[model samples]
Target: MNEKLKAYRAAILHSLADPSEVGIEQSYQYFEDGVLLVEDGRVVKVGAAEDLLPTLKGVEVVEYRDALITPGFIDTHIHYPQTGMIASYGEQLLDWLNTYTFPTERQFADKAHASDVANIFLKELLRNGTTTALVFGTVHKQSVDAFFEAAQALNLRMIAGKVLMDRNAPDYLTDTAESGYADSKELIERWHGKGRLHYAVTPRFAPTSTPEQLTLAGKLLAEYPDLYMHTHLSENRKEIEWVRELFPERSGYLDVYDHYRLLGARSVFAHGVHLCDHECQRLGETGSAIAFCPTSNLFLGSGLFDLDKLERHGVRVGLGTDVGAGTSFSQLQSLNEAYKVLQLQGKKLDPFKSLYLATLGGARALYLDDKIGNFAQGKDADFVVLDYRATPLMTYRLQQANTLEEKLFALMTLGDDRAVKETFATGQSVHRRG
Candidate 1:
């Protein structure tokens, strides 16, 4: 690799493991004045500035004074096609989909419109310091193609798939079982494993896909075991009831996918707010993951997600800004909502754990932990630079913080896009705050 080496100097913070598994101090790595060395888009070394600076004598060094550097936030689940309709008028999940989501997604059938939204959506993600996400595209193959094209241009590590909804959706937004399978296969071949891009086989959910469509989706998933399976689970009570009505033969909503062989280590279901004990056990045993969309759940009147219960069952969970239903693109804002949601459940979400969910936990949920999460040597050099004194309120609050925990608490509780001073992808500066 003949790539030039670059060194970044700043305060560094990252999670090495789940706080629950290891104590806060053991799982958290922080250096007051740190230096991260990168070459060919991978971390070469990370440690105290005094230790690494002397070694990087000839490398280019970029310094950010008093800023906190962390792994770029990972959104475990988000709908890229819903960029235009985020924060639509309040409605329940099913109604919200019909009133706002389906219609907005229908426009993506036009490649030009798809490309336009793709660019804007990606920039918005970068602006919010989210370097990676498992995104949902529209039913149109062009939408997924356009999204991948935009991400590839920026050398971003993105996972996306064209949605498959063969029934229970508008004609313009649906595809038959045969067509859905074929389209997903074509897209998988064209985009999966290309540079930093990967493809997930996306079936909208049990409600949108018929029995035949679900079976075919299962076949596609089985064919490419490495690809991710993205879909919804028991997000809303009404949606769950409707799924039971549709697949009465199955014991529960999650069983519908399990019966079709879609439950696995690579499957990541969104909005598992109302799942039962059996569902949680099944998800854990299969190594499946859930993208807990607190903002979207709260916006759509979905029930509270029991993080303690999920963890007790050994189920893996990550945070998502399920945009459109979710109100913000910023993971810090998402963490803000997650904190409240857990509070309502009579549980306290620790500040350290909150940061873990957006970084390492999200990568673990997507089964990409080995590649992108944290500042481990040989990992991809994707991270964010946060300015603690970004706003007047934060500047005042941070002055009172004397400990690292206190500082991180202030960042998650009070920070947003303005806190993101810069975003880096593969050792390159992708977005700098203007």
Candidate 2:
């Protein structure tokens, strides 16, 4: 009954669990005429409009008709420095890194360039309805500082860290193990847990980092156990072979991180496209996570992710755009690619499950599920409003969809940034379509 509370009315939907694991009925919550009440940057109440309206006297109501409101999309893995180089033609993982990724990332050494790009990158994310992301910065410590600076300005809940690489990269991009550790420690002290921001311990990958640098990265994680550890895994076969050559004494690609004490509950490995069953088992047992980046995988010709296999093995998985190599920033489009990737393997990614991966499932992967994933009481009020009729084709398709399932399927299959009517973070509107 506070005057500060704001009420948003729309058709609401959010995931309770992975539908592939739990049945759809138990995994999702949808309300046709829902009212989400927000106050002081948190969700105060959520229920049928008719039921809550009587109790919300004197509150400002924002009406969104024929729109679907869901928890804001969370990108589990993305490279913030690669925003400018997205969609570069040809080349798979390793080559793509050297040619497009490295050259673009090298520019981040300039503080102004890093600041400018961080502003653009976060705006692009807000435009696409992504409220939170696990991001990667360049090797320069300034890049991480710049990114967190921009994010802090907007009061956004974001996670990012500087790339740690001391070998197998251009001289301009490499940092010594000691320098990497000191830089990461300094940045973490400055930014980690500063309001809504968090820090990630980022080792680019096993091949790019020497054992010394990786050991230091593991040391950082051991020191800050609550912080996140993010890096690349078996994205491509050649890359895996290179990792084997780099750490020949190790049992495998995943073993390199395991041996260095880098595998744990707070760790997230991107693009586990060719991971073996043993690797998956280890990931599950250690409470680590895999970020399934279908858009990047298909664009770079990396192998298809065995989503079904990973799930069956009890591995926690989430969705990512993996920009630069990834084709789109839209999580809906990411879901579209995810659906196709599974289809090629004769498996199905349910529409509900795809949305889950983009939202709650991703939060779970980042170990932030209790804070930002759903419309649970007292959670942060970050969400997106989707215009089901954003496109002429979507309008027609939605007209014929009678059931909620069919309507949701059409939205995921046809939606993109154009479908995002508005995006909000912590009960404040950040981007609204004209």
Regions of candidate 2 where Cα sits further than 4 Å from its true position: none
User: What is the overall TM-score of model 2 with all chains considered together?
Assistant: 0.99
| Candidate 2 colliding pairs | none
Clashing pairs in 1: 86-324
For residue 17, give model 1's deviation from the true position in Å: 0.7
The count of backbone overlaps in candidate 1 is 1
Q: What tens-digit string does per-residue lDDT give for candidate 2 at 253-361?
A: 9999999999999799999999888989999999999999999999889888999878878888988999978989999999988999999999888788887899999
Worst 10 residues of 2 by lDDT: 90-99
